[model samples]
Target: MIMDANTIKDELKKVGISINDIYDLVNTKESYPLAIPVLLDLLQKGIEDVKIKEGIIRALAVKEAIGKASPILIEEYHKIAKDKMMLRWAIGNTIYVTITENDVDSILQIVQDDENGMSRQMFVLALGKVKSEKAEDILIKLLDDEELTPHALEALGRLKSKKAKSKIEILTKHPKSLIKKEAEKALKKIG
Candidate 1:
């Protein structure tokens, strides 16, 4: 059964997402088997409420939603300029879970922008899911990023990036135990 706007809103409310409007629900006649595109369209149309947008983004994090939502989510990630922690984390988590090889370039673009801060943390780690040499190089350079160094180490290890082995080695003795732990884990993976 196709859910109407009110039904969608009610469902969202049930999950603690109390929103006033259902911004652009898909047409009832459309053949979309899933609600992913409807949610992605709202995100693309620029929902102003961070919480609502975050809810939609998180809802679309499922594996079935990846091909349809990844590009739109990346677009939304770029659109966010403020330091909204929950929203940023939501996007990062969604992208991290759904990220594909095709999304690597865009993820790299976002990760390279230091202004995005730790919001890019999950994106850094998501790079591990793709085995691109570009991803490996970027992860290596990200070793210099204090906030993302641990995630970078983890991603390189996921890639089993022999190229990054030396950089990962340097972090093994990092002052932060978390960094040291990740560095060791990454080295084990690389080996």
Candidate 2:
């Protein structure tokens, strides 16, 4: 059954989460085990506000509820408008925080699409957290993307890509401290 806003609000209220607005339901701290289902329900079937959806995505992450929410989050990621930067960023972060082996291919697809732009940075980092040869290869190639070089360096490091070590070493001398630092860190991880 598709829950109306009032029904969703009532469900949250039963869990002591009194909210005057839907976006107010984005709670990061304090595990609301009772409210998770409601939030998930709302995320799946409730209002269409990108902000509220973004909030729900972030709240789910903070609650460590990604297992139940990951598929829905990925679906939402594809359905949302490209201009919804915050929500896109939230989904990327959710992937980063709760990445699993099953998600490697999906994450690779997202990162490969340059249309997703920098919003895919966290997804790049997520690739590093898992053991995937394809993901490692992609990260190595992404090192050429100036906007994403730091994230690519970090991911390649996490994968301990020996193939990327020489390229990463070059980045250590990059004038930008962030890139240089990421390059140095990746070298350590690769070692």
Candidate 3:
């Protein structure tokens, strides 16, 4: 069924139709286009529900509505300081969808402030999606972090950085098989 934003909003008001159900529907390509505008509207209303906010963010990313969603996501990021994982994932998805130079500094700041390894890893991967020299430098620095190195290497590979080639080669002999495999793949990508 082809639903407009108003119709979707009404459906959401129904008691049993939870946000997760909306999320599942919006995750599909056919439904995402219809869902994104409504999701953005809900976000704009300042919905306090964390799950709803996350669902909206994911819907925006899945629909590739970065241009329309980035500003709102950044605003939400600034407002949400306690939910580190959610913020990181939303930012990562935003970066992945739209690798703009304007967002690089903010993303770097988030990476610097976050102490969680997984959040840092997600942010590092997001940084790789940015096609800026600054992002490349940040990825290089993260290569020394044992916990983040594998993800960093993967991001560098995605960025296709020739400067990371030597370092990635060194990681090919890492004791951890996952790191070794990722490093080998990164080397190939760099080449």
The global C-alpha lDDT for each of the candidates, from Candidate 1 onward, is 0.78, 0.79, 0.70
* Model 2: colliding residue pairs: none
Indicate which candidate wins on TM-score: 2
TM-score of 3: 0.77
lDDT of 1 at 142: 95
- Encode model 3's per-residue lDDT on 15-93: one tens digit a residue: 3344435466546645345455656667776755566566666667753575566666766766765546755566566
How does candidate 1 score on lDDT?
A: 0.78
Task: Identify the superior model by lDDT, candidate 2 or candidate 3.
Answer: 2
Q: Give the TM-score of candidate 1.
A: 0.82
Cα-based TM-score, every candidate: 0.82, 0.84, 0.77
lDDT string for model 2 (1-191, tens) is: 54455666777898888776555545435566676777877777855655556666776764356456666777778887888766787898977776778778777888888888888888888888888888888999899888789999988888889999999999999999999999999999989
Per-candidate alpha-carbon RMSD to the true structure:
6.5, 2.7, 5.3
Task: Kindly list the per-residue Cα lDDT of model 1 for residues 1-191, writing each as its tens digit.
Answer: 34344555765555455445543321132322246655765567666666566667777767767677788888877777757755776788888878888998999998998888888899998999988989889999999998998899988888889998887888898899999999999999989
Model 2 vs. true fold: TM: 0.84
